[model samples]
Target: MLMVMDEPKPNHWVFFSVAQNSPDFTLTIVFFILPHSEVKMGLKQTIKSLDAFPRAEEHLLQKTQTGALVSVIGLVIMATLFFHELRYYLATYTVHQMSVDLKRGETLPIHINMTFPSLPCDVLSVDAIDMSGKHEVDLDTNIWKLRLNSNGHIIGTEYLSDLVEKEHADHKHDHDKEKDHPHIHGFDQAAEALVKKVKQAIAEGEGCRVYGVLDVQRVAGNFHISVHGLNIFVAQLIFDGSKHVNVSHMIHDLSFGPKYPGIHNPLDGTVRILHDTSGTFKYYIKIVPTEYRYISKDVLPTNQFSVTEYFSPMTNSERAWPAVYFLYDLSPITVTIKEERRSFLHFITRLCAVLGGTFAVTGMLDRWMFRFLEALTKPKRRKETECGSLSGDGCCFGGN
Candidate 1:
């Protein structure tokens, strides 16, 4: 099928039809293929049916070309959609990480004074336990009771009753946790006996430290410790064989880890240093909780594992969360996160392809049919006529 526009051949109009007239019924187009200098009398003008005109077959080819171009554009759009989907499937989720500030380092208010009953009385060991709420039917609501290690040398039940009263006397309070242990007597006296022993041992040149560092180690790893009362600290003084041992210099070399006390790792319980210190030796220590989560090694070691301490946010928390941030990336929920960025682009590309392809195919068909219908119904130029009139060029068919 084809559509054609031709330059009118001069002096050739095949002017036999009445449709070609001098006035009225103006056509949409005009063709003047022949020389205009021929001085013709009012050349082709009005439009009429092909039933009144005819033309050479060579002119139909132009319309077919138009249809093909439209088809190609549509095909390109559709193909782009398929390619976009392929790229998306191969896309990988990327995790962008930055050093974040984590809130850590909460100094526990509790402190213990150690005392031992037997050895030289110099090694004072103090232990306390409070476990009156356990063994109830509802473990969630039930308070896990603190208890004494009756099977061993330590007497936990007696210590709790005695220590609480004396410690709280500064605030004029009682051990409300020990309401069940009403039989305990002279809580203040017991506390006094222990404190007096600790003072005596300190005067006699003995070791005085916070007890239960082991309990903490069993749950959280060794972290940094910040001593609030630096002025009243009892740290080991290194001897330079001089008049004074400057312990303050040694404290300067130590660091404290996160405040949260890391997670419970039976084998992971230990402390270490992450930074370089000025001193050759570090006085490492751990402070246990008043209550034990589980039985731990009887004594804690000064050195156990490699612990990195920092004053910043990622502290010696129960579990170092930063180490596991990658877990969030590959999780199932992350698919939605990934899709949020990726899926919409794919849908648009695919839709464009579909629409574009359909458009091209439609354009191709429309152009071809339009040309065929045009050829069958539209009027054609008559090769023979008055040879010079204003109305014989294919009824001046509208824009070929």
Candidate 2:
């Protein structure tokens, strides 16, 4: 059998077949119709007149002068609001939040740079003690001392280890490890040499600058620069009297943690001067941990602090020492500052609201003004028609 099919039409098909063995004995025709009417009707019916936003035909729209003016003003208002929102969306802002501090068993890094104008390097020692009974005595490993002349110029630089080794090499035979090294406070023959060196430097009007990092446990602690680490006899011999030992100093930089942008450390460039009397200088500080989050999702850990200072005059007691002390305590709260920008969706919604509200308000105002003008003219039109019907064009209704 040979079968032939005609070109398909919408929703219908036609097929014809001939009997090849009988040389065209019979011819058959068949029709197939596809059920697509409902689908087409459904698609066409999806576009309905129940629209949230509707528009009038161009021929039906009547443009009035008042309506045009209202539209122009509304456009201006929308443009102004849109520009304002755009600026707000493009600008970056910082959000600050506070929470309880949860950090534990961490060490705090302190960077200190100070200069003593009237104190010699041999008589100045750095020591730290905390409320936890942890004493960091004679902190010298990471510290550097710069010898300055009377004119505040650097003369020489010395490391703590090198200075100690030099002193020990000169007085090796006189070294007594047991009695001399008692708690790092008892000075032996080597200490006597250090005192002599200090006396000579004092005669030449010398000064000292100390700068280094001190890593201590995170707790309330006090670190100071004084002659407290020296033996009583050695300290007494360095100067004429303990009362004359001046503790005047200048702080270059003092911070609790690594520096980041916008971090202000109050202790930088601080100067303290003492007169003829010796005194103790103390700084009571409160440290708050801070974390800064950048827009790129990078985080920086740092610290900020506030300080209160006090000074106490020293008496003639041998136990009294002149020093510059920094006492600090950590706050239990942490602050987080994050950089953020407005979301795109939020900006879009705000823009749409501004446009829609202005348009609707202006349209209502135009309609009300048009109706008021129409009401005012309606009575005049009625009087003119009545006069024209009663008396012809020559009739005068009023003085005119």
Candidate 3:
């Protein structure tokens, strides 16, 4: 359905159209009190009525329909949830393709020296604020995330879009994990929500921090994270070298690597950061860090340190959830960077398991409900009543 309202002074007309089976499929009324611009509340409502949030719902969802309408709404909801998962899954696919380099069984040990271009890597003083997080894991390994790369710095104009994309006003990172390993078999839609929460955490700077050489360096910002279904902030610090800070310790000790072989072939991907005068740097995001050592031809060691080691994608995860907060294993502590590809792949496999399982479970539920709806369309057979002859003695005896 579409509506057009004309306002002569502005020489403009408002156009509003509602989808056939959407919740906001009927006439909508809105009120606005704006003194500055000519764009009134009516115009705002019209625009909002047209912009369906897809998987999300408005405060007042259409609820009049009883049978058929409900079915349609359910179907739409299913589609939106699936799409949300697909978008994140695709995003992970892109990240995974750009970072890892190894076959299923290939091995690369740590403790090797490597050399790369001596280009000047840009540096920045970071101030990380964890909107949500939990330190339920072991004290030593509390902030571990399961990804192929480390927490990276943004460099160059290439990553400006991504940097902007990940930014949000409030970072909420309390993603709950069930006891299910790798992936849960059901609740695919919920999984999508979880992925979103994780992304928000990472983008909003859950654990990102920096410390200058000063007296105040003893304090780390509060990281807001939920623990075992409780909302709380994980306190950490970024200290001067003389005194150790909690967040600084985690950042310095954390390790990242390849989840699989062949994620980036030819050579270990190199991430280059060019800092211009504008206090911003440029980055080619899909490249690996300049830290791996290629001993002879076939053997390689990956334990070396490079600046860009923080932003490679060696595994397939829907978003950067692991990098943001503390991940839970049976034990709940974050693990350090692995020296071999097997360890990395194991972690990546677990992450993919979660993502794929989420998609599959939701898809199945959607299909099942659709099938139920189709069954409802079948015509019901009615039974006919047969009248036997009345009692013989009565006048209504069977006709001869």
Task: Choose the strongest candidate by lDDT.
Answer: 2
Query: Per-candidate TM vs. native?
Result: 0.19, 0.58, 0.16
After the best TM-score superposition of candidate 3, give how far the Cα of residue 144 lies from its true spot, in angstroms.
24
Predicted candidate 2 versus true structure: per-residue lDDT over 1-400, tens digit per residue? 4666556777743333434345755555455545477656756677654566778899998888888888899889989989998998887788999999999978888898999989877777777666665434443347788999999999998874322212212221122442566476666779878888988888888999999877777899877777665556676678656677899999999998888767889989999888888888999999999999988899988889999999998776534567788999999999999989999998899888888898889889999988987899899999878888867555655533
Ranking the candidates on lDDT from highest down gives 2, 1, 3
Q: Report, for every candidate in turn, its global Cα lDDT versus the true structure.
A: 0.30, 0.78, 0.29
- Candidate structures ordered by TM-score, highest first: 2, 1, 3
Report the alpha-carbon TM-score of model 2 versus the true structure.
Answer: 0.58
At residue 100, candidate 2 shows an lDDT of 98
Q: Write the per-residue lDDT of candidate 1 for residues 1-400, one digit (tens) a residue.
A: 2337454465654222223345866434443343443335243332324236466488664655546665565567656766766666455443222232232332322222222211112221222111221221211111011221212133222222111111211211123423644554433565556546544543444321223321221222221112111111121111111112111111111112222222231223222223321111122234222211112223211111222222222322211111100000001111101111357766676666666667766776777777786786554433323333534553434322
What value does the lDDT take at residue 3 in candidate 2? 63
Superposed by TM-score, candidate 3 places the C-alpha of residue 50 at a distance from the truth, in angstroms, of 33
